[model samples]
Target: MDYVSALLPPVVMAAFFIALVVTIVKSQGGANKAKEDAAVDAALSRAESARQSQP
Candidate 1:
């Protein structure tokens, strides 16, 4: 019972961590991929332009 109590927290944390990872993995590169890519590219372009304009 002592060992079970000690190990239970880690087991529960690991289970939730795995679930989080699985959710993130499943969300990648789906219908929103193009929109996300476009948004990132636009942000990068803006940053680059701003940097160039500074100096």
Candidate 2:
């Protein structure tokens, strides 16, 4: 019982960590991916325009 009590916290934390990772991975796909890619491309174009406008 002593060993089980000592080890339970790490096991619980590992489970929660795995769940959070899975959620993040799942969220990165589907409709959100297209929007995210577009936003990134827009940002890069804006940055390039700003650079060209400077030096």
Candidate 3:
């Protein structure tokens, strides 16, 4: 029916969005978590040091 057709796309998109979120959540905080965090910290520190040196 018209209502079923209208609702189907939204339902399908929501299901895929939920799956994507679940995959992202599961991929986080494993063996690479510390490595990723260190990389971020290093980048931030480098930026801060550069900003301090600018003036």
Better structure of 2 and 3 per TM-score: 3
Which model scores highest in TM-score? 1
Pairs that clash in candidate 3? none
| Candidate order, TM-score descending | 1, 3, 2
Model 3: per-residue Cα lDDT at residue 24: 92
* lDDT agreement of model 1 with the native: 0.97
Worst 10 residues of 1 by lDDT: 24-33
Q: In candidate 3, what are the lDDT values of residues 1-55, reduced to their tens digit?
A: 9999999999999999999999999889998899999999999999999999997
| C-alpha lDDT values of all predictions | 0.97, 0.97, 0.97
What lDDT tens digits, residue by residue, belong to model 1 across residues 1-55? 9999999999999999999999999989999899999999999999999999995
Model 1 per-residue lDDT at 17: 100
Residue 49 local lDDT, model 1: 97
Q: Over the stretch 1-55, how does candidate 2's per-residue lDDT look in tens digits?
A: 9999999999999999999999999999799999999999999999999999997
List the RMSD of every prediction in angstroms: 0.9, 1.9, 1.2
